[model samples]
Each structure stands twice: as C-alpha cells, then as structure tokens.
Target: MTGMERMQMDAAEYRDNQPEAKSAVGEAYEWVESFLVPLLAFLLIFTFFARLATVNGISMLPTLHNGERLILQQAGYAPEYGDVVVVDRSITDEDAIVKRVIGKEGDVIFIDFASGEVWRNDTLLDEPYINEPTMLQYDISFPVKVPAGCVFVMGDNRNHSLDSRSSDIGMVDVRHIMGKAVFRFFPFNKFGGIS
Candidate 1:
C-alpha cells in the first residue's frame, strides 16, 4: 500500500480499538457507582446510624414476638412515651431488654392494681396496645417520679411482663439505651413498622 493509504488504515485500526478501552473503563465505573457505593452506604448506616436486634421473649406480646428481627435506630434516639426501645444490660445479667417507654424523667407514674389503670403525670393512659389491664403489681410504689435521665418502661403484655413495675428492672437510664426498635423485618407475614 502507499504511505498515505497505510496511514489511513492504521488510523482506522486505532479508532476501532478505542471504544473497547473506553467501554471497559466505563463499565468499571458503572459497577462501582451502582453496586459498591450503595453497599458502602448501607454498611455505614447500619454500623453508625442503626442496628439489628431480636426479640427473645413474649413480654411484648401482641406487639412483638419471640425471635422476631427488628431494625433499631441508634443515632439521635431520645426516649419518648410509647416508643419501643432496646436497652443494654439494664436488667440484671440480661444481655438486653425490649420495652415501651411509660414515663420519662420527672414524670410521675402511678398504677392502681385493683383498677388495672396506669397514670402518668396525673393523666390516665389510654393504652390500647396492652395485652391486658395493668393488674399485676410489683414492688415499686405508685406515683413514683422517674429520676433524672431515667425512663420507666413496661411491656405491652402487662400481666406477664417483668419491667419497670418490678423492682428487678425499674427505671432505665438514658445511657443504657442502645437503640429504638423502629421496624420488624422477620416473620414476613407480620412485617411492618413497630407500633
């Protein structure tokens, strides 16, 4: 071939090879963006901002069941009345405990065992989530004020739960709270946000 013709042929070959090189780099970038980035983000969120916990007993029956998996939000969790929380070693020798917040710091809690009523700050709580009426009484006296940075907790199953009502596990400290149970992931049939 002539010199110019050979140069043209070489240029065509170079053009043909360029797309494959660009395609490979583009594909790698796409993979990283589509998969790796999202995976890393998920890991970071779960590690720092959230956690996973499992229900161990029937104390929170009708609301939570045994072996049920839950998504707990850790960062920025503040104890609020009616929120379900997972605590860290608050109960004696127990790894963790899940209970609903009944009262916060400075709030007064009173329970009338005969009437099965729970009063918080002079207002009777209309607790529809409870498995039964609060008839089972423990050692703690009624109208007790929650100490500073502490919260009173109880299970939804009032008759069966051993919680703040009992002297065994009374008021929970704010620092002992690991996270709040926001959603239930296991037992797909009952999968939804924790009420």
Candidate 2:
C-alpha cells in the first residue's frame, strides 16, 4: 500500500477509537450526575423529614431497645395521647428522649407517686402498656395544669426516664418537638409500625 494511504488508514482507526472513548466517559459522567447526584439529594430530604435513629438507652426499654433502628416522622402535628414521640431536647438542655404523650394543653395532670398512677382532671389513667408496673416516687406531684400549647410526655419505662417530670425539662413546648416514632425498621423480627 502507498505510504499516504497507510497513514490515512491509521488516522481513520484513531478517529474510530475516539468516539468509543468519548462515549465511555460520557456514560460515566451521566450516571453520576443523573443517578448518584439525585439519589443523594433525595436521601438528604428523606433524612430531614423522616429520620432514622437507633435506640441508645434503656429509658424507653421494653417498648424500644438500646439498639433498635426507628423511623421518626418529622412533620409537626398535634400528637394524641399514647403516641410515641421523638423529642428535640436541645432547647430544653436534656438529651433526646422518646416518650409517650400523656396529657395535652389545658389538662390538669397529677402524678400519684405512691400509687404509680397518673391522673387527668382527677380521673385515674389506665396505662396497661407501660413496661414497668410502678413509677418511682417523683418529687413533684402537684396537679400542674399543662400550659396552653404544650404537652406532657413520659417514658414507658417511667422509673428510669428523665422526662417532663423534671422541672428543668418541665412541659415540652409543642414547637420543640421533632417528630413521632412511627416505625421500627431494623432487627428484622421487630420491624413494624411503632405502637
């Protein structure tokens, strides 16, 4: 073959390989920008709205464990009594605690330390779901009416939990609440909606 013809053939081969090289690089860049970037953004949004938390202490024991993974819903809502809630204690200077709502605004709450019973407006509460049979004696037992736009929360394992019972963390402001614990996602057997 002539030298010029051979050179032209080599040039064509190089040009042919260029498109394949460019295509491989383009696929990689598109994969990252299209799939990876958006996937990470979605995760950040999900974590902000629905957090994944691991139970760290025995404060909510029996009802929740020290290592269980829980799904916390973050949207603000008026939580009803008996709903398990995840609280943001930074505003109160207490650690993050998971507790059940026991009373709401405008309700009179009385804790009978001796009987381990809670009362709302002088009516005794029937709390069969509590982990412990009796609550330890708390120093404050006066019938404190929950202030307007606040909630009274307590741990299921009442004896070990430091909750609204403490004056420092008194009634939790409705705004400081982060979300409710609506499901447990880990430890296969325990995976289900949080009661």
Candidate 3:
C-alpha cells in the first residue's frame, strides 16, 4: 500500500525473525534473573527489616490517609514520641493500627479538654501536625502514668480516634510495636516520608 505502511510491515517481519532463544537453559536463567532472584531478595528484606502496609481508615487523616501505601521499618526500632508507627494486635489477629506516640514508659499523660492541650510529663507537646483538638476522652482518665514498658499512642485526627486513651487499646507494649511507618509511596501527590 503506502510507503509508511510497507515500512511498518517490514519492521514487524524483522522483529518476528529475532524472537527470544528457545534454549531451555537460557530461558530458565533469564527467568531466574528477571523474577525469581528479585522475588527472593524482596522476601528476605521484608522478613528481616521491613514490611508493606496500607492505611485502612480515616483515623490518621491530614497526615496519612486510607488506602495510602507505606513501608514499615522494624529493624532497630525504638518507639519515640511523635513517630507514627504501626502497632500489631497479634493476640487477636486483628489488622495493625497506625498511631503517633504520645507518652512513653514512666511518663504521665494528661489532656485538658477545654484547652485542647496535651501534657506529657508536665511538658506541653509541640504538635503541629494534629488536624484538630484532642477532644475524645476514653474510659481511662487523664494524669495516668504509662506503665513501665508501654507507650501511649493517638491518631492525628484526635477528636475521632480510638487509641491509648481508650481501654480497648490501652498502653501498647513495646513488643507489640511492630514497626515505624517510614515512607508513603501511594497517591503520587502524597509520595514521601510518613511524618
């Protein structure tokens, strides 16, 4: 037909002539390099130091959101105040919850509902990331001392979160603190480290 059409047909014919090798050994090696090796490496990495998780609710909105993907880092993790982390409920086999650390072992926690101020061990925490006031009071009252080996956690969407303040998930043990959410890699608009 046309010159351009004829040229395209000739190009397709040339490509068909240079198909991948039919050698079994060569094909197997290529498959291993392209898929098996990388898969094994990923499994090893995830098993030892990291995991992939997704935000499952709106509890952490304005900081992290539902359906956003995260890379949870576990190696050498020490729960620190203000670090957003994933807490596992292995005892119940429930999906993990992501929350921000508020008070650590041996610290006192109090929240003034009227002023929306949170004091940990007599110091007002500088929380510039909270979406709103911490108005949701749980079964446990304030001024409670966190146990010797646990952390008090709350979501950034404080007014509507169910966290350490509630007896339901009170004082998460350090052992149940699975990993810190180090990175967010979904919804290209919010691609970066988890704050």
Candidate 4:
C-alpha cells in the first residue's frame, strides 16, 4: 500500500477503536453514579432510622437474651405505656439499657420499697411482662410526677437493671429515646416481634 493509503488505514483503525474506548468509560461512570449513589443513600437512611444492637446482658432476660441481635427503630413516634424501648445512652455516662415504659408524661408513679410493688396514679400495675415477678427489689422509693415530654422506664429484669430507678438513668427525656425494639432478628428460633 502507498504511504497515504497506509496512513488512511491506520486512521480508520483508530476511529473504530474510539467507540469501544468511549463505551468502557461510559459503563464505569454509570456503574459508579447509579449503583454507588443509591447504595450510599440506602446505608445512610437505614442508619438514620434503624440500627442493629446486640443484647449484651440479661437485663431484658426472657424478653431479650444476651448476645442476641436486635433491630432498633430510631424515628420519632409516640410511645405507649408498657412498650419495650431502647434509649440512647451516649449522651450520658450511663450504659445503653433496654427497658419497659411504665409511666408517661403527667402520670404519678409510686414504688413500694417493701414489696417491689409499683403504683401508677394510685392504681397498682399488673406486670406480666417482667422476667421474674419477685426479682425486683425496690431500693428507691419515690412518688414522681412524670414531667411533660419525659417518660419513666424500667427493665424487665428489674433486679439487675439500672433503669429509671437509679439516679444515673433517672427519668429519660423523650428526646433522648432512640426507638422501640419492635423485633428480634437473631438466634433464628427467637426471631419474631419483641413483645
């Protein structure tokens, strides 16, 4: 082939390779932009609304066991009395404790140190959810009128738990509440909604 024809042939080969090069680059860009962005967004939203926590001790006992993995919801929702909940303890020196809501805003709570009996607004509570009924020893007796925007919480394993009764935990501010433990997803057999 003549020099000019040879040059033309080389130019044609280079032109043919351009689309393949462009497509490879386009595919990479699309992969990062499409998959990576959504994946990051999913992680952010999941971490923001829901999080995974391991039950460290038997504070929850039959309700939640040690080493069990739990899904904690962290959204702003009204919590009813008797609902099991998880609170954020990072703001204070207290450890993260799971507990049951016994009283809400405007309720008066009384604890009889002698019998471990709890009275809400002069009515005794019938708590079948406790891990052990007599395990609780009411050391601190207080007639607290739960303040507005706050909640009174206690653990199911009341004897060993450091919850609202302790000065450290005191009455938890509603704003510090992470969310309720709606379900337990680990230890396959115990995998169901957390009552």
Q: Report the number of the highest-TM-score candidate.
A: 1
* Model 2 RMSD vs true structure: 3.1
Query: Per-residue lDDT for 1-195 in model 4, tens only?
Result: 899999999999999999999999999999889989999988996778877777768888778888888887776667789888878888766556788899999999988766778889999999888776534544444888888998999888877787888777788898877788887899999898888
Query: Candidate 3's residue-wise lDDT over 11-121, tens digit each?
Result: 998787666544666888898799988899999999999988888898898999899999999888899989999988869888889999999999999999888999998
Model 3 clashing residue pairs (backbone): none
Output the number of the lDDT-best candidate: 1
- Higher lDDT: candidate 1 or 3? 1
Stretches of model 3 off by over 4 angstroms after superposition = 1-31
Give the whole-model CA lDDT for all candidates, comma-separated. Answer: 0.92, 0.82, 0.90, 0.82
Badly placed stretches (over 4 Å) of model 2 are 1-15, 33-35, 91-94, 122-124
- Alpha carbon lDDT of residue 192, candidate 3? 92
Report how far off residue 58 is in candidate 2 (Å): 2.0
Q: How much does candidate 2 score in TM-score?
A: 0.78
Give the C-alpha miss distance for residue 56 in model 3, angstroms. Answer: 1.8
- Minimum summed lDDT over a 10-residue window in model 2 is located at 133-142
Q: Cα-based RMSD of the predictions, in order?
A: 2.5, 3.1, 9.7, 2.9
Q: Between 2 and 3, whose lDDT is larger?
A: 3
Q: Model 1, 100: alpha-carbon shift in Å? A: 0.6
> Candidate 1 at 59: error in angstroms?
0.4
Q: What TM-score fits each model?
A: 0.87, 0.78, 0.82, 0.79
